[model samples]
Target: MKLSKGANAPVPTSLLAVVVSWRSEHAVDAHALLLEGSGTVRSDRDLVFYNAPRHVSQAVTLDQEPAPRTARLSVSLPRTEADVDRIVVAGSVENGTFGDITGLTLTVHAVDGAVATFEIEDADAVRALMFGEFYRRDGRWRFRAVGQGWASGLAGLVTEFGVQVDDPADPARTTHPTDPFRLHRSARTSPSQEVRSARSATGAQPDPAPPGLRDRHDLAPVRHFPHGSFASDPPRRSAQSAREDGATGLTSDDVVVQRFSSSDDDADGRTGQEAAHNRSDASASVRPRTDLLDRAETAATLGSYRPVDLTRHTSETAPAAPPPPPNPDLADWHSDPEAPERLRWWDGTEWTSATCQHHPPSNRHCARCGHPLRRKLLGGLAPCQRCELEIEEYLTHWHTQAWRVLTTHGPRGPVWAALWASLRYQRIDADAGRRALRAVALSYVERLVTFTFADGEVQHAELELFEQAVTELALGGPLIEDLRRRMHRGRTLSRLRAGDLPVVRTPGLHLDPEEKVHVDLPATHVRQLARGPKLTEGRLIGSNKKLRFVGAGAGTEMPWSRIISVHAEQETVVIAATSSRGGGTFAVADPDYVAAALEGALRVAKRLVLTPGQRDTRSIPQEVKAEVWQRDGGKCVECGDGHYLEFDHVIPLSRGGATSATNLQILCRSCNRAKGARI
Candidate 1:
């Protein structure tokens, strides 16, 4: 049979099963409370079933099944050993209000096949509901459909029942009773005493206290007794009463009860009354003197009081005083004054239930911008609302730029500028920042050169392959060389000394008298030419007697007299000479003009060679020569001697070796002569 709200039914058998079911539309959780005689739970153990499940032997077992969204509790009255006098079944939505969910039902089954069902039709604004309770009554188990709810969910219910939740912020934290319920239970009056008190308050003669409860202070006084009891009999007269009853001497039944009276008490009462009257008369005499003194003082200060004109008075009410000004502190939530570590929510006029306990005030700032956080935005490190918005905007811009760069030739300058600015505010280590930059750069390179699946997504292996390709490219290109120079500039002096390089006072070059910069182009360190080298301030320079490179960290000069050959290849000018240091190569912004200037200064006979695939043994590019020279540090790589240094190709040209910096090596004249071309 279907049970209505507040309906009660008896449990006719020793064993019972209660099942609660709900639709999947709500993510509802189930809980069961084992209450004592009082409606509240006495301890955490009394809460039998929750997120953490437990079984109280074969007597009471709680189980939850997810397949059909149901929770079951089985109770065996015979084996139940705990002092649990009542069981309350409840359900709560995990993360939503119950007003949004529907189709909630609960059912109970007995061993004799008797069944009771309850349907919950409405639960507006409720987050948790107590569906029903089973209590022991009159030696029989009875079920009552309560259908009550709380908007504060399970946590509030736990607190209401005297359990102290350790951490309100963490719902899963342990709970325990604030104080034993037995202590409070001892102070309450018994049912019979309550009944007597009710009768006495209604003007009815109350029943006498039972003999067993007579000494208990919490019980009412004895008023009426049953007939034939000792309290109903008259008292026997003593010998003293007989002596005082001389005038009324008679048999015990005829003896009139002599009312006891005290002559000393009557005299004392009359004296107390006279003393009270005399004290009142003295107080009245002192009051007039006090009034005369007050009048004298008032007349001496401001003369006599003015007479009132009551006849001409008008009936008008004064305007109410203006309301007090609003308090600015109430506009924002702050930590509770009594509990400094816990936050308290203040809603303008009053405090609310909302509160938060996070990190101490010292650490409450934005992790990205270091701005003070008035409220928690996300994670442990609180971020102010404005900083949170800025962080989101920055991340979005970064992602958009990353996507664009990976797809096509995108503007990298702006991206780099943004990165530099972000470093000032973002709390990231130097290595992490560099890694992020490299990753973005590699991602772009990967999309530009690698093939993807049909859906345009690259696999892990494919991504690894692309990363390797980009890393290899970074080893020699302008990009890698620039990065290396930057890394060198940022390194400490210990690193430079460890490399066995001279610790120069200034890492920049000083220009010579006659040398002038013709064209300046920003250039990266060529591996074979410069190690930890700074940017060359002037890329291409001409002098009356030589060509010079005024670099920020180191300078190289090629005297016109020592120039054996000069070759122009694309945007590079290569020179081979007999100077103490092997000749250097350079990249110029205006390659053609630099080539012409070099030729005119050196008085070269042949026109500058500009075409590709020209095997000119006379000269190697200045960049290639500098790269080879710097790689060997102006010494022969084979012998480590600083004499007659020359640039030689590791792989001979006839063997299809490209005249690139990686293939070129520094050698002494003797070693070059020893290692002839294989052809």
Candidate 2:
């Protein structure tokens, strides 16, 4: 059988079996009497063994001569590690179910020879059985039954007998008595009395009585015949008066008897008898002439108890009493130092219960009322369970943004920014902040398009791809709508950024806005010069200023920030295009230093240059001028007057003279296209 979690070790031969076909007051009395008389009863009622086929062992012989033909098996609740009892069976047998013996009866016998039989039909019915072995110890009886497991058995048995399990511990019990006639009908037939008599005749006259019951004459007081034995011509008026004579012996009639042994005075000779009489008289004179019952009544009346001399008694609080034993179930987890506190309970196999020495929280009282709340209720957070859930959600969102920000701006910068934003005093409008976050992302996309490739040439296709990536990264619009109707019920995360955005980490580009000219090379590092201006400064016209470059020379400050461009074709080196603080731009190509510094294949250095097609001033092209004049009407030959049009060239060539209307400039076809195709 599987043991319960934290039970004591196995004790040896402490359990006794008292098989009864019924559970009545008489049966209970008989069981208790047997246990008490034997004086070998275990405190836990491990002695009261169940007779079911499952719990009980098979028949085993106690002695060899004239075999008893009775089962005598002993089992113990383990008291120590070495005390476990192994169950053994003598013959082939199947285990018994609880249902097999639910309809039993018990008998309870009072000390006064009054028997009260109770049926096994409810928890109340089995209450006596559950407390089956109260031994008469030191003149006072105490309960000696196993308390926990029997409740289940009792409940199940009562269910079989059509009753519910109720709290029998309640003092207010009103259980109906079982039908006496029906109970008698259901009682199992005991071995016939004639057969017992025959067995007694055949076997060694069954040891006349149980042990410690010898001294037959001393069992009770001597009767009336004992009074005549004094050769009494003078009849005694009272038993006490007869006892006063020297020859008349005292009996239970004169003595207040008890379960505990009490001493008595016996008459020996005339001298001894006189002395005994003298002693009795002196004892009576020392106290009062009151009956023992009167003393008991007086003690009760005075609300006094017999002074308990507890020196000889074993106290429940003695030092030798074992510490609450460990429970066996948590043995494995208790061995680990890092085991959770709640998981650390008493494990019988190991000491795992940790002392929680941490100071408790401050929220000691309930918010709704002033009553003191349990520590666990307020130990973690207000609305503790719900608060934990909220924290988890908050952490999820924080981590999601953390990964993205770290990848883009690196750990230190992004982490500091996040910390600052979180701690700042300014009010954060979450909705508008989210919109501005979109603009920030788009600005980075625009900046990345300005980067030149390794060949020092920028591709419009790359720019288009960058734009597509930005569009793809945007919150889903049409695609999510299509997916909603086709694949899912509806789009839950409509605001979620798209995952299709490509991660492009082009080298030789200023990936971060704050820092500049970050080149991972060996010796000759090229960074924007700190003493120079940024590329954003400076007019289109050139002044006398020389371009700043990141070179090893005596400069006021290091020009590491003045990295305007880079060149890696045939050489892994960076070129400075602009500098911080309005410094000029310059290229970096120290062959010995650059070659020694640069590692890896010099595929091509990416450059950052102005877009060649973009100009500071705007002007109309020749095609746009032609199209405008044609769309507007031809002008008059005299004034070259045309509605919102300029003079245009015609087929009349200036090389060969041919006076045609197209050759003349008439503004708005008014001057025969004046000043157009003229010689």
Candidate 3:
């Protein structure tokens, strides 16, 4: 079994061998500290090392010998004192830091020959590391992979756990290493070092090999609990008891160390050793016959959890809580620090079935509606669940996201120019920015090209893969088009953006000068305003100046000023105009966008009347920008990207939208430019 850092598995038995191996020319000393329940050692007597290789209780022993690159320790848990709850395994190198040595590994071999291994992946420049521990939890002993290090070496490590450091009385002690984990040794100090037969003549390792060392070898994957799973197992039976019970060749080590998710209080309000005993009897009654298969268990016993390894980022306002004890505060919900996107409810004393959808997948949050996606809606350019209107419908949502991204990435200008500025910001020279953007673009293209499967329908995952891709790469145009088509949903995103605008021209329409079309919903059906029962098949055509429903006959057209507010339904829009006007209820393909387009066109008509010569000015009020920044979480409104931000007028100002906070939304240059990409 391979254990990841911070992961734990129960040891079937206490009598086990732990070996620390690394490929280094320098000798690395291994030490074990027997810790009490209070987390401190009883005294220097509990320390096991080269000089003091055996514990007073006869429960633990340092092998004092190694197989080439490995050091071993034998632990007999049954012989350990009840007061001693944990055995901490640690190692150190006095010659240099662990970073200088590679391939550091810890292997635990149980009496049943079950093996669990952990490799320290991130070896820092620290002198010592608390590799892991075999600790008692609810009467069960489990092994945890703890790769924490100490920069101050073993002295600081021992002192932290209440060990006193004193100068040795013997003169040779002065020459010997003082750090508990790093017992100093050298060939120059020993007179017979040359003829010591390759043994650690420095006395760290025994010259003669230890017994039982020859039996250890590669073993099969132990039939154990699954990773990050909860299991049910009783208090471990002794090796003698298992043999007498005739349960195959299983020993006390044959039992798996298991953890429960809840307290006994949730049952009959039990506590202390009484709680443990009662639970043991209760679980033993349900324990299945293991003799049915000595090699593997038919199924996993069900129950709960173990130690938590939390690594998550919390909101800026409230820092994450420290790793809590087995039971902290009783009630309410707390973040699952390991899985950031989940909330685990603490029902006063134990975990309950209470849960809710947790935080979003990204670190960013949306400003206007407090969406977890920040400006990016559902990891796409689509409208947020709350704010369903397109950019043109509402214009007060982009300032803060824009300013933040703009300043960090250089400046906000044209869509592609802004992203270029952000990507190339602070580059060494003029060509640096271009090279950087091209690199990103190439990487994006490369990923899609490598995936051979190209079914016509695009999966959400595929679209998200290129949701932030640089769409304007001239050299990648042809391939990007093919990839875009493969990933696009129903229609191209460029069409969606165009559909959100204040104008969408129908191909065959002959329009008058300045009579711009805003929206065109095809395959639409209509009903008359005069309470006519018959339905008419038509296309709903919306322009900046009017709303028209064209069918087989002369189409009905009404000026925007005469129409009342548009009501949007699932797949239809209700256009209520004056009794004399031609507007009517129309069933359309996308009523939301159609309704929003009509509303936008009406606003444009009103704006044109109010300011006939008004031109688009790319400026937002500072106060409004500040409010927008706070609301949109200071990131792009479409996607929470914080670089090269531009205040994307959801509805452009040229279409008669106001420069208001409600209409402002920040979008990164990449997202803003991706609006026109085919995908």
Candidate 4:
């Protein structure tokens, strides 16, 4: 479809080719800037032009070969950095103004036949034109036909976006005619050779590299500027350039173009066939693209097809497709014979004791997750509308409290009911707690669901409760689907755990029927202070009874009650068993998770909570220390460093990990404090 200046169109694909075609001998070079939401380039590496032909992430690149005179930029939107807001497609003239050219059009081509073109009508004596921008809107990508230009040229344009380009006007720097000019000039520019320093916009020294990128002094010099810290480049003609650019954004990406035509039959009363033949080609200049084949023989051999005509000669009209059935998880008021004064709460599937009066107000926010209560079933929500609580905060605080409540009292039982009642949300009823209890209910239900799916199965009673919660909370299909996704992953993990036992070649491995499997992961035993070949490949399995590894010709078993210390060093799990043989360092999948499972299982096995060796405050619980010792085999579980030992929680206690043996582990001083908050 054709677009006017300031009008926009949706780019329908992640991969596209943006071609700027103009009628002129003047050299016009295409350039793109990866801008942050603050409307400035993140770094000089974000500038992709002839000087920097490829973006650091390869999200945008100037095509090495272009068709005749057109300039093309290949875009891979998915490869773009998460913080990158948009790609500004601009062009600079090294020789003449854009006014000297004709047919100035920017076209974007998708893999499919979707094409969007914007034509520049009035000519202006500008050195650069912002052809358009491929930007993100509500999570989807779109293009806005800016057709805005600046009189300050390419060097001035680069300076506007937080870059200190070697200015041509300074006379100290020589000009690089990167263009259609490259085809005729002696010197060709390479991104690495023509590189400018991509420092902070404030001209501060570049910040230290990200933690993951640090300590590798041999890596390439890609830079990042902190968000909200990029102060505008001073002495740049940004203000004056903005004044010359008159482009204004249009309403939306989904533009509709209507076609109105006057046929011969409708206008001059001629036949339909005559109108088509007469209008087939008004002039010889319009010709069929017969480049692919010349043979009419192929056309004769092709299959014949006809369009379906529903309005033509049918005995009866075809029934219109019935609209989809309303959502099963619907909430509406239903009449009750017993209470004529009030309608009963029909939570989609059944009559609920909750009255319409008990329903939360529209503005109520969840006290638990801090997510807003859905105002109505299947309705839209405010974008990014979240309360002050971060997800980590919820996990650490409210979620922990809820889990503790469940651990003390079984789900769907009387104690569980009492805990729900004691939620004490005081919103519309009094303080800021109206309808907040429902989020608590959701949280508790989530825990129950997780526990139930641990065995790879869900009871019918559990499904009913889940459905009731959905209807009561006015949840939509997407949220329901997400819950199902959680269920599926849990079930998959459970089944994999169950499969781990049968593969053990060591026939001595056995489990009582009551012993529930908690952890099952591939492991390789690491022998400390060994002569050679430290690893003994095996499968590590844990249950409420014991921790054991069974491999080719080797086997090791440690009863949970006999374990002393459990440690995680890097990617390995070490268990110090008091009377167990074959106990050593085991490199396993997610050592922390294995350590957690072992501690929890040990607590269940021993049923005791106290550390005899701990002579300190309650910060390191006595019960947790005892279990960690039993699970880790009475030594520093990490690195076999028996000295300078410390007790660590596999999953921090604040994040809902149990305080008993399950969460505790042993670590040496260096291993425990290696990663600060990241650990």
Candidate 5:
């Protein structure tokens, strides 16, 4: 297998794309490129030579020798100097070959007998051909999986190498593995302390703190920076007088960071045989810049492992502390008003509980909690500890409307179908959306339903859906009364199909009017309705007493106004709205939408009552104020101010906040903070 060219050899102006076909069972087929030269190839036959140097080599390596195989060839015409600079060799598992590629290695030799070898992963060896140096060592090769650094080599070759192997493999070829290249070591003048900031505060860098320095909780010991105390220090380069003379320029913590390496053939190393197996530690040189072991160790620490304290000198490290208890404030935000607690905040660099003196302490209350005093106690998103009963209730309501429109009329079930189509374009997958607790199909419908609500103008025809749905409800009958003015009447650019149901929006809405009006809406309330030419796959439902609409097309009949008070109690939200003309009470399912709608309706009410005369009239009877106070549990909404309170509309009535007890709230002096009279 001595493939070579001499001093008088023709300069290859094009690259040779080689593809080997083989079969294997027990052993995987592999290949490697051992040379670089310019030439062009086409399939298993055509070959064209051009004017370029050489610069490509790849190997299809295997656990055992490759099975009987044929090589396919292709040529890439030279375009720049890189094409003439080096050579390239690529390997592949021949067509109809058997078994997987278990391992691979490549070896390249120059005219002057300069040889370079590399053991690469079976799949990536040939791809690694882009890097000129490719060779095998000792006849045995160990393949390793690719990591982040491999992508760097690809960029360098295409941009820096100028040589492009344009003939990519056919449909079935496997992807290339990463190439592991050695990074040149940086020069060290004199070693300095690598200290954590805590020790840096003092005048000088503190000596390396021994391991277990803060072992006991009661010890209250201090730790200095430059942690490698046990390691030896580098020699100083001083020349002047004793004090100003030949002063050892090296600081007390100055130490030459060195790595211990063992020769490949050496059997006298600390871990001897075990160390020999790892190629990274097989460097013979002790030179600070030439040692691969040191580079490998540094890379290993930064690339994969967490920062570790390796100093063997024992001084007793502090015991890890138990996590803090969950904050009660966050419990109210979750579906369940009374869920178990979780861990609180930790501002440490690595959750080590070691605080930085310069940084402010984390707030005690949970950050995500609506309670100004409470925060999201846990680190990130905690698992679903509470039941999704509220979400399910909302979904139930959405489902009723979804099922009605999906099964009832039109050519394409309901709005859910269009939504699924839009989500597909958004690149949203079921797994990702579900993880975020979003229903893809439902989101499509909701977007179409609410686009024109908050914003004054409707940007698209979808606004008609929200307008139509809202019209069926009595409370804000005039809210969406002008459907034509809000929407652009465009052609049917998109429609939901029957088979596309899985990808389309599914609507759900729940209406409970017992103690209070509770509106439960499906979680898919946010995805876009349509994108480019695709319709999104989710829907939203606005549930008021009179109307329960799904998408822009469907609705469910419910006595929503007959609702009384709606509040979260434990796992369920109770709604106490009256039915049969305020005679008997109907305790329907949970309604999450009611709160949000109340917020929306209040905004409308506030706008309605914003007249100058309305401000001084004091139309809110004293009796109404008393009821509102009791409903709020006599708590302030601002500053947490408790006394000298007044009745305020949660959603100001002028903006559509109702005169109902549920819409009004009690606010103390501090609670009203800057909430001036809007009317």
Candidate 6:
């Protein structure tokens, strides 16, 4: 519908299109100012859109429609943006007043069709014209033909809308040439004049000047004087007249004035001497003081003096203050008065009714073997240094033996070893722990080993008989009934070895069942040592006093009396012995177990004596064997056979050669015999 000035129409949709067509005689620019619900612009929300240096909004955008005399503004109506509530469409003449524009029309269209239109006919003296506005009322939108005009141009409208205008003449005022929204001071008025005009427009009176200060416009003009210019010369008088006046002591009005001029000079050019003579004459005119005694008497009469007493004052001394008493509430642990050997606990505010008997401090020693603990084991209840190294060697041997038994004799060997060690060291009920071990071993066999129909699936009775046989061979059970009861549960052996499942403890195993066991057998010891990622899982088993390690796909063993030196290296323990050619090194997961085992092994090894034959036997140690095996790739060096290995002396013992690792090498039995025959 065509809308004239002051006309209005209801808008249906949130999205609306505004088209402005103006046929102006001069260049004119169309613009719009987005305002809030207050019908006013705020610094944070107000946005100005113009032709040059165009401004775009997320909710309202200017379309690139190809209409020569037209500008299109697309408004997104259903806007969640809380800041924009109204859009004011306006136009301004670039170089001429709005009166110079002929036909100016602004039309708003909804999706259906034309919603409203504003037309301006006479805009004389107006440089900016607000054509129409689209605003929100309640929950609905409406369009109004405002047709408001400002004679002071777009800048005036911008200032009226609360934008600050910078003085155009201010050199310090920064403005971007392409910024159309920047308001510039009007050329007709300076900043001060504009301020005055604003005050006048607001009906605010200027403050009155302070009293006695003339008005700025009413002040007299100051006169300027050139250099060496004089308004009038001083009143001329003769020096003789001045001297006569001085002799007569003339009155102030009759006194002669002497003038000194820069131009004064004698004909003989003696200006300096003349100046000196004049100064002397001036000095001679002053009267001299003749009464010295009279001057002294006058000074004495003017001066006042008084005598002060020179004696000291006396006063009595004050008494000293008393010291503070000791605190009664403070408490500390002290020897018991009744029993000097006992200590009594004392709470800070008062003493508690608790007393503890003190035990004499003993030299730290291995709890298991009673070997004197070294400085390295002094931290806690760790075993002596020897035990630590022995434990590592024992663990290595146990892991290898366990894996070998598991692969060769079936899981029964390792499972029996684990169960027996658990019973002996963990102090668990023999019958119950055996039952748990049997169940675990059965699970392990089922999971790891597959039996075929041809392999002879045994009946329950036969299976029980087989279990009895394994138990008798690996773990000595007294009778069949005891073996049956012990190996009946059929549980997984891995979980039992891992200690995730606990076995029933023997009754009266300790005074407190909850108390931790100080000494553990090889199985529990290795399990404790294999606690970290470096050592995944290991079992230490001891049979006939020989420790073996079974895990990590390798086995290691060392007699209890063979460890010479046991010490820790980073996270591992290294074991060296008088009998071994090289030391044994194993990763340490549980330092306590390593220390305990090493100390015990060392104590045993130190006390035990070997027969002269055993001691002097010219045999290569396991460490040297390992080195030779690796060096020879587990093959005979002479014949290159990978089996029937024998460590032969490179130089025969009869040839005065030392039985050392340097003289040792691996050879097949045939090669060794041939070499012996040749020697």
Q: Worst 10-residue stretch by lDDT in candidate 1?
A: 251-260
Q: For residue 271, what is the lDDT in candidate 6?
A: 17
Give per-residue CA lDDT, model 6, range 1-679, as digits (tens): 7776787888875677788877855655666666755666533124344422222234566664437877777777654233457778776775778776667777888888887877778666788888887776654668888888898877777666644544545566432211111123334543335435645987866322111111224323212111111224323333234222321111100111101111122233221111111111212222121221122222222211111111112234322322211332223334545455644333222232233333344667443233455564446554444434433333333334333344334433213333233222211234544343443344233312112101112223335444644554344334334434323422222112122222233243322323332222322212233565344345543222444555567656666566565544444555565554223545656543454345444444355432212312454454655465557665677778743445677776657765566777767657876776234
> Looking at model 3, which ten-residue stretch has the lowest summed lDDT?
295-304
Worst 10 residues of 5 by lDDT: 492-501
Alpha-carbon deviation at 549 in model 4, angstroms: 50
Best model number under TM-score: 4
Candidate 1 Cα errors over 4 Å, as ranges: 112-114, 168-679
lDDT of 4: 0.50
TM-scores of all predicted structures: 0.25, 0.12, 0.26, 0.29, 0.18, 0.26
Q: Write the per-residue lDDT of candidate 3 for residues 242-328, one digit (tens) a residue.
A: 223322111111111101111211232211111111122222222322221111111111001121111112366344454643544
- Steric collisions counted per model: 12, 86, 37, 23, 147, 31
Candidate 5, 1-679: lDDT as tens digits:
2222211122222333333333332322222222223322111101111111121211122222223443332333332211122223332222222223333333332334413333343333222223122222222221211211122323222323222233333454322211011122232311122223335655554433322211122222222221111123223321112112212111111112111111211222211111111011102111112222223323322221111121122236544544322332111111111212322112111121111111122354222211123224775443221113222332333334433332222113112332222222111233432333223223333323322222122222334444433332211323233333323321111110000011112233233542222233442212223563322222223222242324344323334444444333222323334542322211223322233343233223233213211222224544565465445554565555543455555675446766556666656534543564343
Reference-based lDDT, residue 12, model 1:
59
| Model 4 alpha-carbon miss at residue 155, Å | 1.4
Residue 584 C-alpha lDDT in model 5: 20
Least accurate 10 contiguous residues by lDDT in model 2: 178-187
